[model samples]
Target: MTRVLRLAVSLALLLLAWEGLVLMTGVPHFILPAPHRIAAAFAARFDLLAAHAVITATEILLGLVLGVSAGGLLALTLTASRRVRGWLLPLVIASQAIPVFAIAPLLVLWLGYGLASKVAMAALIIFFPVTVALFEGLRRTDTGWIDLARTMTAGGNAAGWRVMLYLRLPAALPAFGAGLRVAAAVTPIGAVIGEWVGSSGGLGYLMLHANARMQVDLMFAALLVLAVMALALYLAVDRLLNRVLPWAADTTIPATSR
Candidate 1:
């Protein structure tokens, strides 16, 4: 609750600062609209923005579901074999090295301006962190447990299912949570990037349309919506983690651990 208050205060201050800057700068509304002006834009153009927002939200939700599932399955495979982990790890890392900006256009070209392209872009961004996080957790599985199982003449599958899956994976929740947080943050950016390249709708496309007509207030309003969505996603993920990993529910996370 204290942390929630802190976040609320910080966000309030951020908006205050943003509005103050615009007021002090004496910039034209077309160039840099104040928050009140942005509010007006949101009120006036809400229907349109809401429709686009729904589209983006759908794409983001589908992409996250698909990406996390794929990553988790791949991580399980990586857990089963060092040879596969060694071969695939570099490829995963190398994929991240290529800027999304460079790949987004190709996705647009190949998949065209549709929900598929948007979902693909978001999934591509989300998959790597989850895969890497899970792989790392798998590698760091409890060695003592593995040894004990071996001593008892336990089979590989039984030991893994009994001990590794239940125990080590739970231990790795904090790390996996870190990656999930990253994925949550990146989803909006990835979705927006894809929309910027080709989509007819979404906040990114709306911003483009508004900017072309010198409707800075509308652009600002769209941006605020994007920020809010990202914040909501992060919070939802945090809450889900705490619920699913109840042992971690009472623990205070270190700031740097995120």
Candidate 2:
């Protein structure tokens, strides 16, 4: 409750500042709509905004599921096979070198201006951090635990699998949780960018259309809704991670003590 109050207070202060800036600067409404103008726009176009919000949210959720699954599977594969890791790790690293914005249009072209393209964009954005964090965690699992797993299992390739599944995966859950939090925060970027590149419906599409028409208040409303959605997604992910990996929550230490 206290945290919620603090957040609300901060947001209120920001809106107050924004409105004050507009009033003090005597800016045109088309150039910078005040908070009340945005609120009025939001109230007037609530239904339209709601529909686009649903489409964007669906894209983000689907992309998150696909991205996490692909990332986890690839991390497992890399951990299980050194040869595969040697061949694929460089490719994975190289993929990130190209800007995601550069690929949005290509994705829209290939996947069409549909949900698929937006989901793919979101998945692409989410894939790297998850893969890297989990893979690193798996690789850095304590040798002592592996030795223990080895002693408990029959001596064979099966024993290594056992060690990986039983020891390393559990140890790496915190890292996976961290990756998930990051993915959640950025998932909207991919979907929105894809929509901006080409889309029939979405908050990004609405914003773009509003901007072109000089409906600044409507654009600001869409922007505010998108920001709220992103924040909610991130907070939901954080709460889930806390539930699933409670140990991580209590692991933080004071900086002064350190």
Candidate 3:
């Protein structure tokens, strides 16, 4: 397929550049391992890498599910209640102002050096973007649609919840999907950072251990695996979003100026 070929070519070019840099600089193996050295390291330690990668992947997946569920519920509640929004929206906005990594240590300390901390970190990181995107989408629903819904339900005891479920939720799916894409892309950061701060397992933990032992090639191999995992997760989420909302997926403008 064309997409597969393009990806392969891009990877080859990057590997060539990396190999060139190593040869030109005469970097030591401990400092900058060549592509072949990294490949050997990956082949030698495949089992170790696979184990750690599974832990990190589980943490990321759990975090994403928790974060998306919480964010969607909060967005819906916020939309239905101006009073709740008044009380909660400022806090939500303020939370984003603080650097997430700054609180990594606290999360580790509170949750302990286990999967819980990493999952919490990822959920926290994903929470804001999804909530904000969906909330804005719900808020910005076309007034015409809302008015029509209101008129139809006027005779009945229709409440705000009914309006949101019947009208705003449908209108907000595209925005929600966009938020999910962003969430999926960044979800690994929280897990990896949590591992870096304090963890017994995962790729970040392995990278730290390898670096300390001067196993640069192994560290590079782990890094490559992490990148591949992140890319795969993002692509999977993108495909799911496309399948769920094909209209949103297709409603994109061409990059070139018209």
Best candidate (score: lDDT)? 3
Model 2 lDDT per residue over 174-208, tens place:
88888999999989998999999999999999999
lDDT of 1: 0.83
What range of 10 consecutive residues in model 2 has the weakest lDDT sum? Answer: 249-258
lDDT tens digits, residue span 172-222, model 3: 898999999999999999899999999999999999999999999999999
Which pairs of residues collide in candidate 2? none
Ranking by lDDT: 3, 2, 1
Score residue 30 of candidate 3 by CA lDDT: 100
TM-score for candidate 2: 0.93
Cα displacement (Å) at residue 209, model 3: 0.9
The Cα RMSD in angstroms, rounded to one decimal, for candidate 1 relative to the true structure is: 3.8
Candidate 3 segments whose C-alpha is farther than 4 A from its true place? 250-258
**Per-residue lDDT tens digits of candidate 1, residues 145-210?**
567667765554454565656666776676778788788888888888899999978888998889
Query: Over all chains combined, what TM-score does candidate 3 have?
Result: 0.94
The list of candidate 1 runs beyond 4 A from truth reads 1-20, 154-162, 249-258
Best of the two (1, 2) by lDDT: 2
Which ranking of candidates, highest TM-score first?
3, 2, 1
In order, the Cα lDDT scores of the candidates are 0.83, 0.91, 0.92
